[model samples]
Target chain A: MKSADKHRKIIRAATKVFAKKGFFNARISDIAKEAKVADGTIYLYFKNKFDILISVFEQEIGKLIENILLLLENETDPSAQLEIFIQRHLEEMKKNRNLAEVIHIELRQTNKLIRDYRKNKFSEYLDIIAKIILQGQNEGKFRQDINPDIAKLMLFGTLDEISRLWGPGSEEKVTVEDISRQITAIFKHGMLH
Target chain B: MKSADKHRKIIRAATKVFAKKGFFNARISDIAKEAKVADGTIYLYFKNKFDILISVFEQEIGKLIENILLLLENETDPSAQLEIFIQRHLEEMKKNRNLAEVIHIELRQTNKLIRDYRKNKFSEYLDIIAKIILQGQNEGKFRQDINPDIAKLMLFGTLDEISRLWGPGSEEKVTVEDISRQITAIFKHGMLH
Candidate 1:
């Protein structure tokens, strides 16, 4: 296989290992066995376990943001764009529980450096939400007085917390599409009359 | 000091130690030393390190909930009650940065048993928010169609996320009161016009 495919394979295997055993407990050999690759082959594509974990976050979230940007491009209404963005996010997580678990649980490292990296990746996500909120404000859809930073936190935090209920090891029975609808409604219509 | 005071002293010391050195790296002897007590004295007030951590959570959060319950007793408006609740929550965190850091950063242990305990304690918090939401719905202040559980998550998660930006190690310039006001406004009017 090409090096690109090997890289993807290693990342996929690492996600499972980290999600199952957590970032600290997961061994590089466990990931190698899961990936059906040699231990040295794993090193060829990644620096260390931390590098692999960071790559998992960077790659998965990068794809999510890219997908949201693509979906937002053809949509004229910022509100509708926000809705699609949320819907696609839930759908993606629903489709990939391993990825969701790794993103939610395993990424929470105790190290300050890892935490800083996670924060940077999270800021990228917030930036995407900020842009959508800004567009909505400019278009007179969202409230003009709302600060984009605060608004983005509200939007992102809500989705993230709800996602926790449906990720791997969760017992919540709510369907992703249904929850997404409920969320969009909350965002579109204020909780008060 | 009395045994009760000793219990409180140990918790306070552990909070500081845990905040500085983290949960895993912290030693029971360190807590005892900081509290100015013998190592065996800690076992009298607590079972072990985990118990000390849990007690810190239980005592602090239990007090917070009790205070909110007391304050909510006199407030007729559920919305105002929520505003007060959010404000108090932020104020308490602002007042105690050591506890805040330990709760936010150090308490995130990957152990399943610890996660279970955290969830149970968190459920108590969720219950408080749910009651407020339900009360608002009954009073026709909040939308009756809103799911109290989801709404609670949104409120709690939003505050929790924004709190991270202002916690002990955070560099964000936003004040606790100002951010609390912004959060309350979002909970009330939301992002939409």
Candidate 2:
């Protein structure tokens, strides 16, 4: 197999292991076994388990960011853009449940290295929401008084909290479309009558 | 010291230890040392570390619920209720940074026991938000179309995400009042002009 293919295989296996056993409990051997590779071979591609976790974020979130930017490139209406962003986010989480689980639970690690990486990469992902709000304000579609920073946290936090219900063992009955619509409605038009 | 006082002291010590070392790394001795009690005494009031964690949630969140209910007893306005909720949440998190750290990071543990406890106790905490939305709807202050479940998640998630910035090592510059006002404005008036 090509080195690139081997690298991808290891990452996919690591995602599963990390999702099931968590970051601290997961071992490199488990990842290698899942990937059907030798323990030493796993070391060839990544420095350690933390490095693999970092790569998972780098590769997955990098793809997500690129894909989202591409998806939003032609959309001019900020409202439509926000809706698309929400739809895409929910769709991705549903489609990649394991990845979603890892990101949701593991990313909260208190280690400085993980925290620093989250601040950089995760902030970039969150900045997408702020940018959308800024666009809305520039177009006069949103309130001028809205603070993008706080609004970004609200939107992301709402989405993050909502997604937690979709995790394993959760018996959520709401459809993704229903949730997307509810969130969009609330954010686009305040709850106040 | 009295039994109740000793129980309270051990819990306080456990909160500090868990916040510092995390759930998986913290030992009973660490908690005992912090509380200035014998390790055997911990087992007397609690079955194990997990019990202490659950008690932490029960005690802290229970107090939060009672305090908020008391504060809102005299206020008739739903909007004011929400503002008060936001304000109180930020204040509690700020005042109890150790508990905040433990809840923000530790509560995500994948243990079934913790997860079950979270679903029960944490759901009650979140239900407070849903009740506020339902009250607003009944009073004709909020749009009737809003789903209380989704809105509850949004409000709690927003507060949860925002509070994460207040943890140790975070250089967040926004004040609690500023955040409370911003969140209240967005939820009340939304982003739309």
Candidate 3:
């Protein structure tokens, strides 16, 4: 298999392993077996389990960022871009529940080193949303006085909490599109009348 | 001394010990030493170390809930209530950084049993916010169509993310009132023009 294909396979396998056995307890040998590759092949692709975990995050969030940027390219209105930004984010998380579980729960339960790494990796993603907020303000589509950092954190934090609660046994029975629209409505227009 | 006073003292000392030594490594003796009480005395107030941690959360968050309810008693406006809610919440966290650090970071990094207990304790606080949102809708202060649960999550999550970032040397250099107003403005008005 190609290096890229092998890399992708390792990530896919690792996501399942980490999600099932958890990040700390999960061994590279387990991931290697799941990926149908030799143990040494895993080392060539990733430095270690920590590298694999970070790689999974970087790849997953990177793809979501790419999708958001691509979707925004054809859209002109900042409101629309913001709405699509939320929609695509929920859609991405919903599409990969295993990855979402790891990112949301397992990674958080890791050590200080992993937590710092997660925070570092997450900053890049936050910058993407920050830029969107900045653009919205520049276009006069968003509130000019609002701090873009706070606004971005509001948007990210809400979606994150929602996604964390959005699991197998949600009583609300809401669809992804439904949730996306609800979140967009709240963000675009305040919850108060 | 009264049983309640000793109980309070034990919790206070445990919060400090847990914050310093971390939850997993913290022992009952360390807490007893800090509280200046006998090891057996702690067992009278709490069943075990885990029980002490949960009680610390219960007392801290319980007091916060009580304060929020008390502040909202005279205020009829939903927006104002929400603002005060955010303010009091931030103020409490600010007053006790060690406890805040333990609650936000250490508890999350603990075992599943602790995590689940934390979740259960947090739901009560979320319900308080949900009631405020529902009351806002009833009073025509908030949008009628917005989901109270989702809005509560937004408010809580935003404040949480902000607190996590807020520390001894934060880059923002903003006051608690400033952040409360910024957050309240977003929840009450939103980002859109």
Candidate 4:
């Protein structure tokens, strides 16, 4: 495999180990096993476990943002862009329960340093969602006076809570498509008139 | 302190430790030290670590339910009852952030047996919120077609997400009461006309 592919393999492994065993409890050995890389091979690519975590965060969420941003560019309709973001977000989450759990649930367990890094990286993530809302508001699709910051929390928090409710593995009672649709409806129409 | 008061102290201490460290990482020694109780003394009142979690859940949530149920008997007006439920639920969550974190975040980490116990105990918790919604629907204050199950999830999920975001220990930007009031206003007036 190419160097980039090897890097991705390491990250995929680290995410699972960190998620299943937690960041503190997860060992480099466990990550190595999950990735199928030699224990020492991990050292060749990253400085430490935290580095792997940062890599995973940047790689996973970065790729996601990049793809969505590309999608936004091609999709001129604001509603269409928003739907695609929601739909794709749910599908990605469904594909990787461990990654989703680690990001939303376990990652918060760490102290200040990791959290600060997350907040910094999360700006782009936040900005993308804010951009969608801004596009909607500007185009008269979504309501004005909706603070993108608070709205992001509601939007993000709703999805996170719903995903958690579905637990470690979601059954078909609520599909990613189902969540995508319901959240889109809520974003558009809200809970009531 | 009286034995009853001492028991309450231990319960609060356990909640704090469990919330901060989570169930798997939190040790009985830490909880006992925080509670100012002997390790063996814990066994006098409860069976084990699992017992402490269940006890904390019962004592805190059970008392809150009793208070709410008693309060509801005097509140015949559906709207007033709804307001009170929201206010008190917010207040309860604020006063018991540790307990909230433990139950909301940690309890889900348990195995099937404990999850079963939690499911049974959780219904009682849900009943408080569900009963109010049912009353509102019957009184023509809320939409009759809204599924009570879905309504509870929406309301509780919204409130829980808000609490975690506006959590007391959170570096998050808002106050619980601010989010609570804003959410309640949104719930009532909604995002659109």
| Cα displacement (Å) at residue A37, model 3 | 6.7
Better of 3 and 4 by TM-score: 3
Measured by DockQ, the strongest candidate is 2
The number of clashing residue pairs in each candidate reads 0, 0, 0, 0
DockQ of 4: 0.29
- lDDT value, candidate 3, whole model: 0.78
lDDT of each: 0.78, 0.85, 0.78, 0.70
> For residues A57-153, could you state the per-residue lDDT of candidate 2 as single tens digits?
7788888888898999989999999998998888788778777867777776534448778878888999998999999999999999888988888
Each candidate's DockQ score against the native complex? 0.57, 0.79, 0.54, 0.29
lDDT of 2 by residue, B39-117 (tens): 9989889987788988877788888889998998989788898999999998999888777867776777544447878
Between candidates 1 and 3, which one is better according to lDDT?
Answer: 1
| Tens-digit lDDT track of model 1 for B1-193 | 4578888899989888877767766899999899999999899888877888888877777878788789889998888989988998888777776666666654444434467776777688788889998999998888887899988888776766666675545677878778888888878777788
Q: Which docking class does model 2 fall in?
A: medium
Give the DockQ of candidate 2. Answer: 0.79
Q: List the pairs of residues colliding in candidate 4.
A: none
- lDDT tens digits by residue: candidate 4, A115-177: 577677766776777787787778886666566666666666566655655554334476677
* Alpha carbon deviation, residue A186, candidate 3 (Å): 1.7
Best TM-score among the predictions, by candidate number: 2
Score residue A163 of candidate 3 by CA lDDT.
77
Candidate whose lDDT is highest: 2
Tally clashing residue pairs in candidate 4. 0
